[model samples]
Target: MRLWVCIALLSTVLCASAERPRIVQGMIRAGQFVRDAAGGTRDMYRAYKDMREANYRGADKYFHARGNYDAARRGPGGAWAARVISDARENWQSRVSGRGAEDTRADQEANRWGRSGGDPNRYRPRGLPSKYYTRDDLHLLWLCRSAVAWPGTMRLWVCIALLSTVLCASAERPRIVQGMIRAGQFVRDAAGGTRDMYRAYKDMREANYRGADKYFHARGNYDAARRGPGGAWAARVISDARENWQSRVSGRGAEDTRADQEANRWGRSGGDPNRYRPRGLPSKY
Candidate 1:
């Protein structure tokens, strides 16, 4: 249920801006550096993992000290020490699915307790229902042409990026014009690739393997864009960004720094206040 709710919110945002369209990637790269900085949107999962490790280490040290001190005593004269150790072990085990052997026994007991209809994959998230997002809903071709122009909605802005390749070729004012063109190409290619990825997600949700394979073209195109005209910079920044954002709602700060450096080298600031945006990238998401 929590997973479904999360997916629903993400899908709704994607769908909601399907018609209005905005250049979310470009805007973020160009102006939202400070915003991404504020919330730690990038590497948030890494931070959480670090916190979890710290908590576990602290608990382990405390419990190990307690058990070692108590378990050292022996004989009937040390019965009180033995009881302390046993109770401490049980309490610690119960707190964390039981510790080692105790936990293994508890699992076996639970398995037997629910043998009639126990689920082995209860931890696995259930796939979305077949009709989750009809073929029409996730299909980028059928989505609104101007859908991705805002600060937050990525769909419509992505759709518009499909048209940027043509203009990028003629954008020569910037001395490092090649970088801008390459960046534009990355935006276009990454967007189209992302749309197909979304479609694949939809297909998988419906158990539509054959349908999912249809996005194979997108995968190939994405590979080419990343490996060819789009180049290494694109791979490190653009594609990685879309991938990170979709999967983790995050971005890479290191890549952002690289982009800023590249843009600065080309006489354009990634954090420029009055960035010249096409109609696609408005002030909001």
Candidate 2:
């Protein structure tokens, strides 16, 4: 009986010893999680504060993306914190701030993009002070250095096309172009996109085909958005205006109007338009 008792005590001691490391590891992990989550919250606040201080127009989306990206980089805990904070902020803005659903949706999209590790520079506005960015950010724009020598509209198109491609791809080199309209060529690209929208409208009017309306809507938006940020801006403006007008004046039901808007958004976001192309639609469009 004495030997059995000793053996039992020894077994209990061995079990406790074996469990100690696991308990210690779990505690360490829990502490790290709390710290990372706290860091993430700080990251979000810092981004928001920097954006307010920067006070640059059209840069809100960029900041939103940047903040989420910074937070998510910390690890799983950081990502969870970011999502919670972002969702709460968005909910408050949408409900209390009276922001439109579309605006709120766009903000969330930017948030998701950042948290997904996408480059926040995708939404960076032109002429935002270089000081707001790191050396790495500036280096990204430097990829277009090759376009500096090109002249005329040719330069603008070449650089913008290259910019769009590089912006979409992993990385590539492109030269700078001269005679480019200022405002980061935003004005020119927007004008071109507007023209595309107008041309699409004119063509649709001339065709007057009943069933092919959706096709024209998508085509116009796709072409406009293909022009770049300016084009995308123009397309969005036109699409919203047209949808609102039709919903109020054309007597189209809300559902139909929403469907039209969906197609418009789809094209603007670079979705293939042929998906909306109706059977027997002319090849010309």
Candidate 3:
């Protein structure tokens, strides 16, 4: 009996020793997961801030891709966090803010591309500053390509490329301006504006669209506004005229008219038409 008891005690000790290592390993894994998730969240926030500060109109997709890419690089936990955040953001935009389905899908595509380690540079806008890119070597490549063809002087071109990159990196990032529409462009814009408004009306009538009037209104204005100052002016005139007719003749309530006007102004002022667009709309539009 004494020998049996000693053997039993030794077995128990061995089991405890083996279990302890597994528990320690589990704790370490859990800790790493938490750290990775935190890092991913940070990456998302940083990307958003950078996008806002850069405010380069067409570079939004690039930033979206970059953020997801960075987070996914952290590992499983990071990928999970990024996906969760991105889905949540899109959900809020679609359900609450009335953003378009097409836009959301496009954003998701960019997100997936980044997570899968695909280059975000595909969506990069022309003239977007080199500073906004993660790969600084691209700037050198661009400079080298543009360098006044130094015929046979390969070394000179290489030195110029290197020097240009250094100077560009040190220079403060220039603010990108969507330059003003020139006076000469007004005539062409005016014609385009009228066409856009008419097309919107025609589409609405033909589609017999009922649920998303505000989206149509915003889209028409957005298309018109893209034509420049003349388009903006034409949009305002048409919108005001339509609202007056609806309130006075068509018997639309003041509240409805007001909402319509708000949507019109939103698009006219260069706000995204997707902000008023609903899901399930045909993407061909």
Candidate 4:
């Protein structure tokens, strides 16, 4: 009778141990996923900023061009008789305005979910049910489920307590994957914005170039018509304007060359320019 009772008790203990939930492994896997996701989120943010900087630099060139063009149009002689230069200046102004608007929109979109109100703890994990689980609660639940497995084993108690402490602590932390998803969205929006802004900048640059060409052509004709009375003065003004335009164009061409080189390097490495540092002008520029 005594032997049978001992065997029955041992069997019951074994069955209870078998039924205990194995949460430590699951918690470990989840923690690893969270760490990886957090790291990826950091990378995404860096990439977004780099892309934005590239777009800003590209847009800035056109802005300088527009400024130079406007100054040339409003030169010392006041307004010229050529209506074409005036019209071209107006068109360039419109393009510059449009580019400015697009740039503002892109900046807003990129910072949509950024931290606000100077709250440092805004991103810190809060162990709430809706936000995350509490370690104490998870520990108690796990203990309740496995309490019957080894009621009198001190070693089992010690092991369970340690495991519960570690696993529950890990599980109760904020899910980094959530923040990673938000970062991923930011990256997507930034990439799209960068592409749009780059295209707009290129279009504006080309349009400004065409307008400059027209302005120069019209100025040449005007200078030719006024060649009798003050031809020397007109020739000097036109020459100055030509030199200014050429200088601006040459500077812009150099910038474009650098950008193309960066693009080529990125392509050779099979990396996205938006995601990595390209060998070009500093972003602060």
TM-score of every candidate relative to the true structure: 0.21, 0.42, 0.42, 0.17
Which one wins by lDDT: 1 or 3?
A: 3
Each prediction's RMSD over C-alphas, in Å, is: 24.5, 21.8, 23.7, 35.2
Name the lDDT value of residue 253 in candidate 3. Answer: 93
Which parts of model 4 are misplaced by more than 4 Å?
1-173, 205-285
Q: Look at candidate 4 and tell me the lDDT of residue 282.
A: 30
Q: List the residue pairs that clash in candidate 4.
A: none
**Residue-wise lDDT of candidate 2 within 89-156, one digit each (tens)?**
99999998887899999999999998897767777887776456522233335535645676888768
Model 3: residues with Cα > 4 Å off, grouped in runs? 1-20, 135-285
Whole-model Cα lDDT of every candidate shown, in order: 0.35, 0.73, 0.70, 0.35
**Candidate 3 lDDT by residue in tens digits, 70-105:** 888677778888899989988888887766898899
**C-alpha RMSD (angstroms) for model 3:** 23.7
The C-alpha stretches of model 2 lying farther than 4 A from their native spots are: 1-20, 134-285
Q: After superposition, how far is residue 64 of candidate 4 from its true place, in Å?
A: 45
Cα lDDT over the full model 3: 0.70
The 10-residue segment with the lowest total lDDT in model 1: 128-137
Which should have the higher lDDT, number 3 or number 4?
Answer: 3
What is candidate 4's lDDT per residue for 55-140, written digit by digit as tens?
A: 54333322222222222222222112112333453457557766565554443322221211111122223331221222222334
